[model samples]
Target: MNDFEFHLDQFMLHCDAKNLSRKTLKSYEQTLRLFQFFLENECKVTEIKDVKSWHIKKYISHLRDRGKYTVTANENTKVYNHPDKRIDLGREISDTTIANYLRNIKVFFNYLFQSGDISENPVKGIPVIKPKRKQKELLDPMEIKRLLSAMDVTKFHEYRLWLGVRLILDTGCRVGELLELKPQDLDLKYNAMLVRNPKNNKQRYVYFSKRMSNDLKRWLKYRDRFSDSEYLFPTIRGTKQNVSNFEKTLKNIGDSVGISVTPHQLRNNFAKYYLLNGGDMASLSRILGHSSIDVTMKAYLDFTDDQIRQKYQRHSPLDNLKL
Candidate 1:
């Protein structure tokens, strides 16, 4: 009923019209609702026009001051008077977390300013926060081989697991994309598969290696003999496998090998190896289904010094020239 509440609803409607992903829409809704709660409960400002930069700054400071224990949905009611969501508490939240909250606020305010809901933009002067990058762990060739060799093909899901992991390494398709694949999506002859529903909601092609092609052929024969699921990788009940199950299986494998492994990590290894072996950025962008080359570059380009050194020797002009 409040001006801020009405504006927040309108902003969500705009985002929905733009066809933003459900996950993104949920995040935006949560962030904005939390802001609304803060405005009403903390600042006592029911009107959108009454909000100021200091109010926004105070909210930011409040976020930082809150300790880092996770607050459940019930706990959220005590602080924000908004039920049905949990929040982090206890230690100081990460720079990345604060940045995301600030970014959401900026977006909401930008919408309000564009729609003439507010005369001044409170988020205009806030500097963008750049979080410190952590070096991502990658599996080398031998480690990758060890994982593949450890798979027990006699077990049906492990067979699926083996092929699934290899496909990710070979093609860099996301685990969600891999799990969503159907039989018709594959083209073994071309050593490729069609990603019909990638993160960007666009169809893209990702190619596998000849080795992976062979594995797919074998798995297909075995799969047909066992179950009749439409999915490329299905469970014993002939239903699509859940991503959580895949992650759990991967974790067990990682524990056995003494190297923590994740689907994203495998995908990361694929990108790193692809680049080190002379794969182009534009192609990698398309293969990974990123919106732009810049998106792909920003995500997968953070190579460690050792990784850079390894890549350099293979491509060094002097070494290649054979002078």
Candidate 2:
């Protein structure tokens, strides 16, 4: 292998040794491979030492112009039947996605520099890319009610999904973490669950409401009759729940209720509603498994004018004071 490829492999090995999540490792590989392809074909620079800041800048431009899904690292692996194959093939790539690519490349180069494998970091001179934050749409209380009411609780699968949705809304736990939950992870006495498999691989306690605690009691009894799986939300076959299947089921249920919803939307709604109901940033950050308060603030601070007014009315000094 060439010097560039060899270095890339070493960086991946380092990341693996550090126990980075598979999704994170995959993203790093994809971004670096694509960058390497660009360096070789566009700049005719195969050596790792030959890459410059200008080449990286040119790559950013190339990414912006190339559009989404127009290029892949391995063309042979492209699945014809995949849903993403037809999605916005030539549409302009979002700045957020391009920024992610740059971030991944920067991380790889930073690893090389820190390891003393490279004399200079090509990515060090590149300006940090901060994409404009998009406003995340949240489900209103009425919409959430409709979503929950649409599920038929008589059926085992629907009941499971219904309880799952409620748990997510109540606790703000991620879908992946929820799926990894075992019965032992729950503490109905304290109205909380231990998130053993969070995105950052750090375990934390996520709390729920008393009403949700009662619902969990009911779900556990019902779940016991159908399956003996170790996972809290297992399939009929007594296996762990699939994230994609759960997502699709939620989406289908939302469609039946004349609304759009996803596990992420439920999590976002939880954060939004929590802030609206006077939850503090630090507590919210910890509950959401965010690394810092800043991360939580940046995510949920884009409140609408109506939402801001609601918060103001609730906390307004004039209204709260015994005037």
Candidate 3:
């Protein structure tokens, strides 16, 4: 087999072996196509062996040149830190999209080098340019209530629509983790849930109130009657539901109620309220299924501060005594 074909097969097989997601595979495919196109059109080369570092430099230059345009890289790489300095060539691009493209290109080139298609990988020296990660906004209690109330419980789809939001608010579970839940995973006697196959392949138990147990009992009763309710949170039509559809349902419920609520926000609210109501940091961490108490403390530090102040003001022994 030819070098080009061999490299392609090796890289694709590696991607499959790693169990990369479909979305990631698509991005890799696009990057490889772009690399081939650059070699063909930019360098005026017909063969893969003809590709060179000069060609990659030109690609970076092309990206930088786009930043000079009105509606280009500048829009993507907004100077969140400095408004005056707009030159990306001298510094770096803050656009996650551009960084991804560059990284993908480098990975493709590295794969070619490993497959014996190239003598050296030019991308080896180039650093992975990362962007500023934006802070996620947590949805407020009113916003969550609005979204939950807007769902029309009369319809099967709508009943589940609110249930998804409520479950997350009541129990701080990721959307994928929540959907991955099975009917038997819920432990009512313990007031806890076993999150199987969690992030990093770690299994953890999370606890909730007696109210959650009642809610689960009702949901389980309804679920057991259905022929296709093997999963804890089944689809409206009673089949396994995907996270995307569940997300869309949350967004739709928000639109109907005139409030904004996402799956992350729902979980955030639970953590937020849990901290607000005098919940211990370490215990809340265990209930949220967080690997570290540091994560729980950091995320809800403000809530803890408020809780401490409230308790001090309300239950201080000196308050009952005469001054």
Among these predictions, the greatest TM-score belongs to: 2
Q: Write the per-residue lDDT of candidate 2 for residues 1-323, one digit (tens) a residue.
A: 99899999999999999998988999999999999999888889888888888999999999988887777887765765342666667899888999899999999889888989989999986888999997878888899889989999999889989999998899998899989999999998888889966446889888888999999998999899999999999999999888989999999999987998889888998999998999988999999988899999888898999999989999999879957
Best lDDT among the predictions, by candidate number? 2
Per-residue lDDT tens digits for candidate 1, residues 1-323, read: 98888888899999999888776888788777777777777789989889899998998888788644343223435666542243633668888888898898999999899888889998889887788866678887788889888889899988889989988988998898899899898998888889965345778888988988888888899999999999989999998888889999999987898878999988888898899999999999898888899999999999989989998998999989987
lDDT of 2: 0.89
> Poorest 10 consecutive residues of model 2 by lDDT?
79-88
State the lDDT of candidate 3 residue by residue for 127-172, as single tens digits.
Answer: 7776765444556656666766778876667776666667777878
lDDT of 1 at 43: 87
Q: Which stretches of candidate 2 lie over 4 Å from their true place?
A: 80-84
Q: Candidates' lDDT values, in order?
A: 0.85, 0.89, 0.69
* Candidate 3, residue 136: lDDT: 45
After the best TM-score superposition of candidate 1, give how far the Cα of residue 218 lies from its true spot, in angstroms: 2.2
Residue 62 of candidate 3: its Cα lDDT?
Answer: 63
Worst 10 residues of 3 by lDDT: 68-77
